[model samples]
Target: MLALFKSLPDDGSYNVGDKLIGESAAEFIDDITDERVVSYYDVDELLEDIDLINESKALLIAAFGIRSSIWRPKLADAIVDGSIGVPVVPLASAWSDFPGDYEQLTSENYPQYDRSVVQFYQYVAKHAPAVSSRDYYTQKALEGLDISSRMVGDCAWYDLESLGEKMCKPEKIDKLVVTDPHQSQYFDQAESLMSELGGMFPDAEKLFCTHGDPSQSPKRQELASNANKYGFEKKDVSGDVSNISFYSDCDLHVGYRVHGHVGFLRKRRPSVLLCEDGRGLGFTETLGGCGFPAFTRRVPEASSTPKKILQTFPEGTIHQLQRKYLGGDRVSHPTTPARDDVVDQVTDFIHQELTTGWHRYEMIPAVIDETYEREMKPFIREISNI
Candidate 1:
């Protein structure tokens, strides 16, 4: 049998992002159970050891990102079958419409575009008592499907204990970290920005962190080969805890991955996230004054790239760039600031924190605390009783 709790290598060679997801879920379970035993499993192993799993008080899982067609049926089956005699709870989860939209989906059209999203939630509504999502988008999606869920921010937001006192900008910028995405256009753009960032922090140690395995993906291999072109010392992390700990010493982070941004923020350090998709943007919607959008609200014109958009900064207003690049007007989110305002806030965050050596902290850290008090603690108590 697989070990209930697996230990990750600390040497920083581990690169598969799945380990990050599993480790994140474990962190929450550890926090929730306090003294209870918590074992981790991949979806396949999870199904294989149902009898052993049934021995536990509950099966708390994390499905924090978009689910492909492949995982839809399996996850739904596991939740329904596993929860027959025990409760199954999900944390910091979301149903994103990446690669496609879920807004116009119906039972008839869902199968064409991963209808498993609806099926998965259908099982959740019937089996799980309650579930928490990472964004309002997921809540709205579930609500549209008649499945109720709570938007408690990302589960990773709860990883830190005290926020009020710990929420601080580094007194001095010593280390600067940057992350590149797998997408070719974005990768090129991030690489180009390294020189500009280097000039901004001449003395600070620059590091490039890769969240995915270069050995597996051709794009990652390209990223690895090109990473050294900039002055970045590459550090590959293996698990979620390692990723978080890896960034603990860093003064500031500018990255394309959402979790990298989350890891840095969870450590109470300053960071910025460059949105790759709706997941990053939507997750940021819950962050109050934090988060930025790299592209416009709609499909960007072929002439507009992240590089072009970024090049306009410090001179052209975001609104001006939007018009110049033919990027659409900002879409209003019900809860958080629009994309233009967020970009302005994050711009101030970088400049204020970098130049003045400290920026005034905002609502996110306190919001995470409030979320824990109102949502997580109550959920833990309710799940414990069951």
Candidate 2:
């Protein structure tokens, strides 16, 4: 078994947080299989080495975040030509129509254009026996492109049940706020929000935490400065592994970043997500009914006060969500390593496809024709009519 993990940029300027997905995926694979070789490569590098990939018995694509469609055409071509040599399995990967609409395929730009989107779906549908989606929105997005996907939530959620039970719920808690500047509209308000949160919990330690990317360090420093001004401190976590420790030390977590909320939840700590986009809202909606509460970033007026935001969901809601989403007994006691059925399902698919010698030779042409008809034909027809 060969796992193809996503590689960071060659410039060495990528964030450590970006590696979290790949790392977790590798670890999960390691836990399940003993005969596995893990390799990391950028999209271009992977495309260049199609021959090397074809030598492998099975290929696993470890994608965690919203995948860009830039490499879709080439990847699909490689698969259709049997250059990959084996069945390509997408594990815990997701494609979102966020920041754009999937239906209105013509107007979008290169990385998210209609044909590219269709190609990605076509590749998955024809090549991959089963695709694991991170959330409902992603599953629907795949379905929109005539692809079927299973909603397994994020892979990070797999081990959370055990971790949650191991953590102690605090009566009086210190608050940790994870901030980022990507959401420019809410960036400036972070300081004020921290200040107000600090005042509300005067005796409790309010810490400003960030993903520790150097590019975002300046903004983190500014947030830290604001926190210091309001008697709050800054905590710098070195990597994704250390985030668990940082989150465990805090009582409550409020953050704009999805992983920030996830890190705290893994530690069995209460967390609130500052929803800024479809991804954020999807994460919230997936976990909200269970225990996690989400506050909209754009609607600052609605969740004006820290107290109001914190109190939006009841404590029982947190426990319930943790139980359902994370999967464990209601009691705070840990269970015997709750089975990761999703991992099992994926591994089974990989084994079955490889053993059955699934070929895309015949399906490739049909997939291409369908994609052209569904995606490209509409635009071509409109132009011709004009």
Highest lDDT: give the candidate number.
Answer: 1
Q: Which regions of candidate 2 fall more than 4 Å away from where they truly are?
A: 7-13, 41-52, 64-82, 96-112, 160-168, 212-224, 235-240, 289-386
Q: Clashing residue pairs, candidate 2? A: 54-84, 290-321, 291-317, 291-321
TM-score for each predicted model, relative to the true structure = 0.74, 0.63
For candidate 2, write residues 199-248 as lDDT tens digits: 65678767776555434435445665666786766665535454545565
| Candidate number achieving the greatest TM-score relative to the actual structure | 1
For all the candidates, what are their Cα RMSDs to the real structure? 9.1, 18.0
Task: Check candidate 1 and list the clashing pairs.
Answer: 14-238
lDDT of candidate 1 over 267-374, digit per residue (tens): 677778776555666767667545566544343333546645454333213333443454332222111222334334444567776566544445567777787778
In model 1, the runs with Cα more than 4 Å from the true position are 1-21, 64-72, 80-84, 99-117, 160-164, 297-349, 355-360
Worst 10 contiguous positions by lDDT, candidate 1: 329-338
Residue-level error in angstroms, candidate 1, position 332: 25
- Superposed by TM-score, candidate 2 places the C-alpha of residue 42 at a distance from the truth, in angstroms, of 4.1
